[model samples]
Target: MLRFILNNDDIGTALPPGMLLLDFIRYHQHLPGTKIGCNEGDCGACTVLIGELQNWAMHYRSFTSCLTPLGNVRGKHVVTIEGINLPGSLTAVQYAMQECAATQCGFCTPGFVMSLTGFCLSHQAPTLTNAIAAIDGNICRCTGYKSIERAAARVAEILQPRNGTTPAQYAAGAQILPDYFVQIPARLRTLHSTLESADDVKAQPIGGGTDLYVQQHDALGKKALRFLYDQPALKGIRQEGNKCILGGATTVSDLLASPLLQAYFPYLNNYLKKVSSTQIRNMATIAGNFINASPIGDFSIFFLALDATLVLSDGRKERELPLRHLFKGYKQLNKSGDEYITRIWFNLPSQHTLFNFEKVSKRTHLDIASVNTAISITMQYDIINDIRISAGGVGPVPQLLKETARFMTGKLLTESLIREASFLLQTEVTPISDARGTEDYKRLLLAQLFKAHFITLFPQLETAILIR
Candidate 1:
């Protein structure tokens, strides 16, 4: 049985664990505020707030309901637009949208409203940048983004003093949501006690469902599913000695929120911004990205540059493999179906090490990369002591350029070296002409990206570079 609080009601059912939250809400629960557009996690029409207790406080984050499985929300509070709507008055988000005339056709309005409301309910500071980022997942054909931006700013003003107060408390007092939200934390605690775990045979493990649902939503119902997004054993980011350890089910959002990772890699947040939108990142797990084995997976390429390693397990036995070696070929991995990644860890960059990630796609944000690359280097007195470079979209799999890396090691930082390395990388990649770009284009792009790594880190070398 699956159990969770739907808005103000406690509900338990024996529905298939693989059933999507979007289907259950619209068809079974008759909640229509969450529109279905781009059934994949894109477009954000099905965005909704998922409230779960953390550290004895209710924390809220917006999720794309279309890709979220029911089992993933077990013993949690699921809030839709209807859940936040006041009986006789508009919530702060709704009021701001209306005041700014942010809606035209209104198809994407509910999602925008819920995302912004979640922003108000979040523990993040109420800065204008954070406020605008709240709706980065949504797409409106009306091109009324200016008005929507204004609405977001107004909502941030309303939430200026949101600190020292739980989002539920502030929302309840301000009538942004019904007072019942204040009691949800206790209710969830009670619900967690009554929940019983069920065992199912022939279950296909689904984490986040961001990618699985996009690829196989229609065929998932008949397949018994085990949702791993909330598994405690496979959640969290920690540091053991000099290595950063990430659990298999840890989402990109989890990495972004991790203090350990932030302290180790101060530019992590900026690097991840090129990966995906907030709605997708909130659901896409690190292990899933690596296991997906896509040549263009941003995280796969990112971690490969750091020389990350994965701990593989089948519940009883475990083994470690270098992340770069996990992929056997295009869309193929070295592990079997039953074997899953338990954790991923990499050494923290030393004081002499410099790391950078570069990505280019049709769209700069929230789109698949045409070409992406990352570099980690250690230098001593402007001489490269060691270097590793990884790239995607130019090979059969996310590849670590061992040849190029070896050539650059113990080499001086000069324009000639960078140009020679660029040419060296040309032979390492095997890009094909496709929708992203031609093979020749990708070849050129990788060269430019390689040069970018040096120019970005050492602008003084820009004048000396003649790679182009």
Candidate 2:
């Protein structure tokens, strides 16, 4: 049985857990406000706010309904545009849209409203940048986005007086959302206490369902899947001694919010901004990215350069494997069918280490990468003491450029040395022609990205000299 609160209504249905929330909302519940656009997560036409009780307060995040499965919403509050409507007046978010004339054709309006409402109910500061970022996933084909930007600015101004109150309390008190939100925590506590646990060892393992729903949308509804997104054991980022540990189900948004990661990599937010949109990052999990095995997966290439390790479990036994060995071939993994990744850990970077990530894609944001690479190097007075380089979309699998790293180690940092190392990297992988780019283009792109790592890390090195 699937039980949850959907737009101020308690829902308990016998629908399959793998059934999509978009389908259930539009077809089953007869709510047409949440329009169906791109069935994939790319289009934000089906965006909704998912509120979960964390530490006795509701924390709401935007998620694309088309990519979200029914099982993922168990014991949580799911809010649609209808749920936030006032009796006879528009909420602050809706009024801002109307006042700014941000709607046209009215198809993508609900999604934009939901995303902006989510921003109002979030702890993020009420700034124009944050407001714009909140609606990055939504696309408007009619309005030139200047009006949407104006609306987002108005929403930020409306939220400027939030002070220090929790986002939910402030949103409710200010009429940005309904007053019923203030009562969700208590309702969720009762619901969670009575909920049954579904842990089937033989069932298919599903995390977040961000990618699986896209590839096997029709087949998943017929399969028995054990949802692992909310498992307590697989939902944290912690540090122990010299190693940083992360649960397999940790989402990219979790990393963005993590102070520990930010302290280690100050530019993490900038790098992640290029990874995907806010809605996709909020739902895409670390283990799911690794298991999806896309040749150009951003997280896969990022973690690969760190030489991360994974702990695999099969319910009865556990084992450890280096991430470098996890990829056997294109879309193939070096694990058993019953085995699932439980935890991922990597060594903490020291003061003497410099790390960088580079990617070339069709679009700067919210698009797949044509060539991506990351490098972690430990320097000993301008000489490379140790190094690890990983590249994607240049081979059959996400590759750890062992030969390139070996060639660079113990070498002095100079234009000629790096140039020689880049040449060696070209021979270490086999790239193929695809929609992203041609074979020669990827090779040239990888070489430039390889050079970019050094250029970014050592700006003192003349750019013209290296490129020439």
Candidate 3:
């Protein structure tokens, strides 16, 4: 049985764990405020705030209920639009939308409100950029976004006085969120203590369910799944000696929030912003992205450039494999079904090392890459001491560009060297024509992205001559 707090009510259901949260919210709980759109996680029309107790406080993040599984919400507070309403008036977020005239068709309004409410209940600064980013996953076709921008600005303005108070405290005090949020932590502690453990050996392991539900939604309902999203054993980011270790279930949003990653890669946010929307990042796990084996998976390519290692486990034993060797073919992995990734670790980039990730997609954000690449290089004065390059969407699996990296190593940093390396990169990839782009287009795009990595990292180098 899955036990959780849905809105203001407690829920304990025997429904299949893989059942869509959106379906449960609409059909089972009869909450029509969370509308369904795109079914996939693209449209944020089904967005809701998932508040989980962490470090003695409630940390709320917006999640697309359409891609979220019921098992993922166990022992958590699932807040819908209705949960934020006051007795006889709208919450501050709703009032902002109303005051700014942000609503038109009203279909996407709930999602916008939920996302904005999440921002108000978050630790992020009350800035227009952060406010707009909180609703990046939401799509509004009617207002052309100007009014929505105004509404988001208004919401941020309302939160300007939110000083150092906890999200729940500030939100409840300002009437941005209900006072019930203040009592959720204590309620969750009790709920978590009485929660039953699922120990079915025959169950399939699922992390996040952001991608799995989209590809195998119907089939998942029939299979027993072991939810790993909330498992205590597989959830943390810590530095051990020279390596930075990450729990396999760590979400993309976790990476964005990680101080360890930010310390090493100063521009980490700039690179991750292009990975996906705020909602998808909140639920898409690092291991899930690797195991999905999409050619253009953002994290897979990003980690590959770092030469990361994966620790695979089967309950009885553990084994380590280089991430580059994990993928054998298209949608194929080297490990067995029983073997699951439990931990991922990589070397921390030193001051001597420079890293950059580049991607070209049909859309700048919230879209899969047409061609993506990442490069990590250690420079000794003007000479390259060591280098690793990885690219995706130009091969059957995410390619480490071993041959290209080998050619670039020990070479001087110059436009001519980058031009030669670009040629080598093209030879290493076997791009195919697909919906994203043609084979020729992908090859050329990969070459440009390869040059982009050099240009971005080494701004002083006149590498513009290598673009062609």
Candidate 4:
């Protein structure tokens, strides 16, 4: 039996496969604040706020209903726009949206409201940057983004401090699980063995359905979803030893709210803000971005530049390895079929380390990268001491520019040096043609982004690492 509190009500039961979230909420649960949109997961019309216990307490994030599966909701609590209404009147967020005239046609209103609710809780007030980052994934063909930003900020003024705080960290493996992904030719069993095979078949784990939902167009049917929806560790954002460990299910929105990340990786945050729109970031996980294995994953480039490591486990043996080593040539990971990534740890660099990120896309926001670059350089007495540079979207898997790193060793960054070094990169790397950019276009972008990073990292070493 899967025991969960739905909108302050309790339910414990079993369900079938391919049960879209929008339907489950409206039909089975009889809760209808969640609206159905383009069932294909593109339109953000079916968005809702989902809450689950992590570290023995509650944490909430917004997600799209069209792509979400009912089985994924086991043991979790869901709150739609309807539940968000206060006891006597409209919630402060709704009032703000009304005051700012944030809606048009009102079809996308529920999704927009839930998304803003999550955003306002995490960020006291929305800045232009925050506004852009939050709603970038949502579409309002009727009204532009300007009005939404105004509403979000207006809501912030009403509730400066969030009503509650998130609980302590919980590792995914150790948390209290209401159910596991047991293949159901048979139904759910006891409290502890929801995943036990009734037909003795193993389950396929699903996290942050952000990408899996997008895979509906594929010919092959999606594997039965084993919900990792409430895995505490997969939702965590905190420090562990010398590295900052982020869970695979941790949303990009949570990444921006992280004080640790903000203090240590300003450039990384800046680029992630531009990686996708506010709507997508609200649900997409850092690891999912890699799991999707898009050639141009924004976080992939940043992770490589940060010397990040991926931690993989399967309720048994656990292994940790550098992320760059995961690429098995193309669209493939070096997993033994059952092994899935549980968390990612980014090792912290020395305090004085200088790093910069540059993303080249056709548009400023909500677009895939043509060429995304991340550069990390540490200077010792004004000479290059250590360096790591990475490029994404150019190769089958995102990787560090080893040859480019080699060119910068022991050189002083200067205009002439940056220009020459960039040229060396141009000669060493080759990019394939794609819709975002052609082979020659990518080559030029790679060289120029390197130069831009060098210039951006100025004053620390005005000479520029690319020049060196």
Candidate 5:
């Protein structure tokens, strides 16, 4: 059975652990405000706000109901459109959308409103950029985005003077939300104490359920699954000495919000923008990305270049392996089924080290890459001291271009040396033709991306001469 606070009411159910939250809300509970579009979480029509206690503070984030399992929300508060609706008055976000004429056919209105409301509850700066980012996962098919943008801007204006107050306090004081929200943190604390964690020993471990629910929804619906999304042991980003450690179940959203990563990878946000939408990132775990073994996983390729290692555990025992070595073949891993990734750690790059990542995809965002590559190099006096190049969508698995990396070490920073290494890279990858692109196109694209790494890291290197 699962116990949670649904909207304002506490509920328990005897449904299967893998049952989707969308079905539970719309079918069993009979709440229709959360629509069902693109049941695969891409459409974001089923967007809902989930509030969970973290370090004694309540943090709220938007999630796609379709991909979220019922077990994942155990002991947390799941807020739907009905939870935020005022009987005789409009919420700040709702009023903004209505005043700006943001609703078109009204099918996707609730989702946008919920996403925006989640933004309101977030502790982020009430800036236009952050407001716009909150709704990146939502898509309005009627070309009504301009009006929605206006609504978002208006909402940001309303939150300008939030001061240092809590979201519940500020929102309630401003009449954006009801006064009941102010007491939810204490309520959640009591409710959380009574709930026990799902035993993962005898069940399949699923984090976020974003990918698994999409790929194996039918099978998962009937399987006994253990939810890892809220496991305290598998959530956080911390630094120790020269290494940075990230819990396996940490989401992309968590990584983006992490100050440690932001400090080291100043362009972390820009690099992640090339990944999927906010909704996907909010639920997709870094461990899931690596274990999925997709040749084109963005996080997998990114971490590979950093020489990251995975800490694997079976609840009782633990082991560590280099991330690149975990992938043995196409969709194959060098890990036992019982052993799961618990943590990932990588050495921090020095000040002299240069890092670059690039990807070309069908769409600029929310699409799989045709080719993705990353390189981290340290040079002294124009001579390469150390370097690592990693790429995906060009081999059976996410590959560390060993031959190419070895050739660049101790070599002077010259167009000729990198040009020669690019040729060697092509030989290292065994790309095959598929729907994404032809085999030859992938080969040429990877070569260009390699040169792109150099051009991006060393702007002084002429692009024309480097490619030649």
Candidate 6:
């Protein structure tokens, strides 16, 4: 038996494995406001706002119905487009969609509206840049994005009066009963594990099923996996002392939107915003990207470059390890089936230090990286005091160029040395060819990227002062 809140009503849905939320809403509940587009989660047509209560406080986020399994919504809230706005009275978002004339074919309206709705609840009168981040996960091929931004902006301009200030809360006392498919032993639930600390949590640990579903649905790889999601543990990003701890389930969308994150680690958002389509970023987890361990995972490139570390834990114990030490060989990680990534720790650079991240991708959206570079340098009076350089989409793991950094620090910031250093990076990496780019291209780019970093460093070197 699974329980959740839907549209301020307590309800239960006995979901079976492989039952998609988009299908369940359209078929089981007979609600049609949530549209379905690509079943693979590429299009945001099936977008919905899912709510979770953490420490008795409620927060909301958007999800693609196409990729989210119905089972994942258990003990949560499901806010469909129909649930938020009434038949006659339009929401600020819906009314704005009408006022902006953002719809044409009608296939993508519900998703845009739902995404705008989530954005409206979470944001105030948003700027175009913020609007781009919020609606990036939602694509409308017919209307382009101009009208959609207008509709989204209108949410802040709504003139109607409201009934007090309480946003609709998904009720907690939901009715639940037994189902035939799968059930935990009553003893397991009775034990030490809380509902939030659900054991045997495999597929649900994943945020957006883009990767998981692609792995399962493609028939070329790991198939038929049920889920991965976290209600509390895998959700927020905050700093603890020297390191910034990002939840394993933190989304690219979250990283790009966070003011605190940008103030400290601006390069991550600046580079990752160029990664996947806004829809994919909204759902893909930073942890999942690392866990997937592709040599080319964009975030890994910057993370490894930034000298970030990752935390791994089984239900029993937890350990923190250097992110560069993660790969054993090609495509293998320190994580085992019994263990999972719990958090990522990136050392926040001081105000005076300079950190940079860049990636060469096949396309601006939904393309794999050919080569990625991260560089951090502390300089004083035209001499390099300290430096760290890491590369991604280049080797088996995001490789730390320790020897290269060692050879360069305390050296004169000269043009000749920068050129020689670029050549040294080419020797450090081994490349593999795939659909995105060739091995030769990666090697060539790695060398060029090194040159770019040095150019940025040398000019600042003479003018900049080391923190005394």
For each of the candidates, the C-alpha root-mean-square deviation to the true structure, in angstroms, is 1.3, 1.0, 1.2, 7.2, 1.5, 7.3
Task: State in Å the error of residue 327, model 5.
Answer: 1.0
Write candidate 3's Cα lDDT for 1-468 as tens digits.
789999889899999988999999999889999998898899899999999989877899999999998989999999999899999888999999999999999999999999999999889999999999999999996855999999999999999998888878888999897788888999999898999987565689999988888889888877888888988778999999999999999999999999989999999999999988999999999999999999999989999999999999987899999999999999999999988889999999989999999988999988999999899999999999999998999889998988988987898888888888888778788999999999999988888788778778888764365444
TM-scores vs. true structure, each candidate: 0.98, 0.98, 0.98, 0.80, 0.97, 0.79
Residue 205 lDDT in model 2?
A: 95
Candidate 1 lands at a TM-score of: 0.98
Could you give candidate 4's per-residue lDDT for residues 37-80 as a string of tens digits? Answer: 66655567777766654444345666777766666666556657
- Please rank every candidate by TM-score, starting with the best: 2, 3, 1, 5, 4, 6
TM-score of 6: 0.79
- Cand. 2 Cα-lDDT: 0.92
38-61 per-residue lDDT for model 6 (tens digits): 677767888888766545444567
Write the residue-wise lDDT of candidate 1 on 49-79 in tens digits.
9988777778788999999988888989999
Q: All models: lDDT?
A: 0.89, 0.92, 0.91, 0.68, 0.91, 0.68
Pick the lDDT winner.
2
Model 3 TM-score, 2 decimals: 0.98
User: Of the candidates numbered 1 and 2, which has the greater TM-score value?
Assistant: 2
C-alpha RMSD between model 6 and the true structure: 7.3
Off by over 4 Å in 1: 199-202, 466-468
Off by over 4 Å in 6: 54-57, 159-198, 201-208, 217-228, 231-238, 253-260, 266-268, 277-279, 454-468
Candidate 5 accuracy as TM-score: 0.97
Pairs that clash in candidate 5: none
Model 5: how far is 27 from its true place, Å?
0.6
Question: How many pairs in model 3 have backbone atoms within 3 A of each other, for residues 3 or more apart or on separate chains, i.e. clashes?
Answer: 0
Higher-TM-score candidate of 4 and 6: 4
